[model samples]
Target: MKLYKVDAIVLRSREMRDADRILTLLSRQKGKIKAVAHGVNKPSSRKRGAVQPFCYSSFLLYRGRELDSVNQCEGIEAFSGLRADLDRISYASYLAELTDSASMEDQIDGEAFFLLLTILHLISRDGADVELLTRSFEIRLLDIAGLRPHLDNCVGCGVPVESETVGFSSSTGGVVCGRCSGIAGDVKFFPRGTVEILKLLLKWDLKKTERIKVPPRVRQQLRQIMQNYISYHLEKKLATALFLEKLYYHY
Candidate 1:
């Protein structure tokens, strides 16, 4: 059996055979891996804590004909702050799910790994606003994954947008000029501020976006727009996102 190591973050774990678990991990080198961790659920298990969702750890794995097996592991950053706060944990779960959904086994995605680690680092700290950081993360993730929205030009007409306000066409994959706005099924006009923030967030990291105070109205608009964009691309609603919305919006 061939043995190797992966620096990975645990995406999820499901119980199996009483004490073992099947783990979904997003690895720095392997992209995504499904590995079996034997005895992880037992009372005296050492890998129990390190195999849970959202744990960043180094995994010792052995190649198997069926699937990889976790030989041993050690925790790096458990994101302990996220565990104590319900809201932060919810958002962090969304990130983990998104990464799992977007990633593929044996496909190296350095950008996605770094972007996810960066967001987790920010969310685990105290200086960042969770909402803004989440929004920024959404934009940056898409950007790194090559799904970034076109902000400066029209998706339909191929013209430089000159309007102070414009409609975003999710179906068209970008902002639409007024002349091209009426043709898309999911087109909706956004005010100038919303458009500006959307443009700004695409290139900004957590450090650069941490201090910008977005007004409540614009923040809500950004969230709605991002949700729409994600739904259009990913074709599924994020459950943790809905939970986060309910926690914040009294829904």
Candidate 2:
């Protein structure tokens, strides 16, 4: 069997046959790939820590026709903070799933690889704004996947929407001018500043997100807009997203 090495983050780990796991990994070199971790479920397996979801590790894999197999692995960072808190874990899982959903197998997405790595580090730190970070991730990931919403100009009329209020259409993929709002279905109207904030979230440095102060109302609006926008493009509600929603409402 041919062998290859890659540094990757475990996006998901699913139970397979006894003492084995099927892992979805996002690698810097190879994008997304699935592989089996034989015996990683056993109490004595050394790969246990490295194979868990959200662990960044170096993996030695034997290439198989259908799927790769983990030969040896070592954990680089366990992101222990995420595991320690329910909120962090939920948001982190959503991020991982979003990354996995947007990425294609064997396609090199260096940008997304680094984006997820950065987000994992940010969320793992104390006092991190997980909600804000997640909103940023959603917009940025959509952009990375070439599904960026039209923010600067109205999606329907091509007119720059500079009014205090504008309509956003998830189906139309961006903000709409007042005159064009009637053509879109399920339009949500909010302050134009909210649209500007979305633009900033897409272009601003992720590390500097803490500096921006968004009002509670704007935050809520952003969340709703992004949630709808992402679901429309992906064509399905993400499982982690549904779980996070329940977690939030239950609290």
Candidate 3:
């Protein structure tokens, strides 16, 4: 058996037979790995906290023909802030799921790994704006996946979008001008302010997002547009996203 060490974030963990757990990890060394941690599900298991979702941990794994096995592990950051609150947990879960969707097995994406790690750290802190941070994560994640939607010019007409109102096409992955709105029936309209903020979200530093306070209307529009855009590319709605929606509706 070949042994290797990796520092990783647990993206997902599912219980297995007799205290075992199947873990999906996004590691610094290897992009995405599926491994099993024996006895981690048991109450007496020392590795319990380290194997949970959104945990950043260091693991010594034995490579097998089918799947890797966790031989030893230690928790680096359990993100207690995320675990302690339902809202934070939902947001963190969305980020984890998005990262898993964007990553590929055995392909190292240093930028993505660090982006997620940084965002996780930010969202885990006190008084963090989890919703805004999540939006930033969504846009950045799409860019890293090479699915960034064009915010500058019209995707259909090839002209600059200077109007007060513009349409967004998830299928085309960009904004559409009034003249090009006929290109798709699903094009959603956005105010120029919302569009500008979306552009800023793409270009601005993630940490500095707190300075820009968005109006409630614009925020709702931005959320809907990003959700639609992400869902189109991923070809399915994220479970965490739906949960968050219901979570939002209740509050």
TM-score of each: 0.95, 0.97, 0.97
In the range 147-219, model 1's lDDT, one tens digit per residue, is 8888888988789887878889877788999888787888999887798888787766567677687998999
Superposed on all Cα atoms, the candidates' RMSDs to the truth, in angstroms, are: 1.5, 1.3, 1.4
lDDT of 3 at 232: 89
Give the per-residue lDDT of model 2 (tens digit) for 3-110.
Answer: 999999999999999999999999998999899999998999999999999999999999999999999999999999999899999999999999988889999998
Using lDDT as the yardstick, the better of models 1 and 2 is 2
Q: Total clashing residue pairs per candidate?
A: 0, 0, 0
- Where does candidate 1 clash, by residue pair? none
lDDT winner among the candidates?
Answer: 2
**lDDT by candidate, in order shown:** 0.85, 0.91, 0.90
The C-alpha local distance difference test score for the whole of candidate 3 amounts to 0.90
State the number of backbone clashes in model 2.
Answer: 0
Which portions of model 3 miss their true places by more than 4 Å?
none
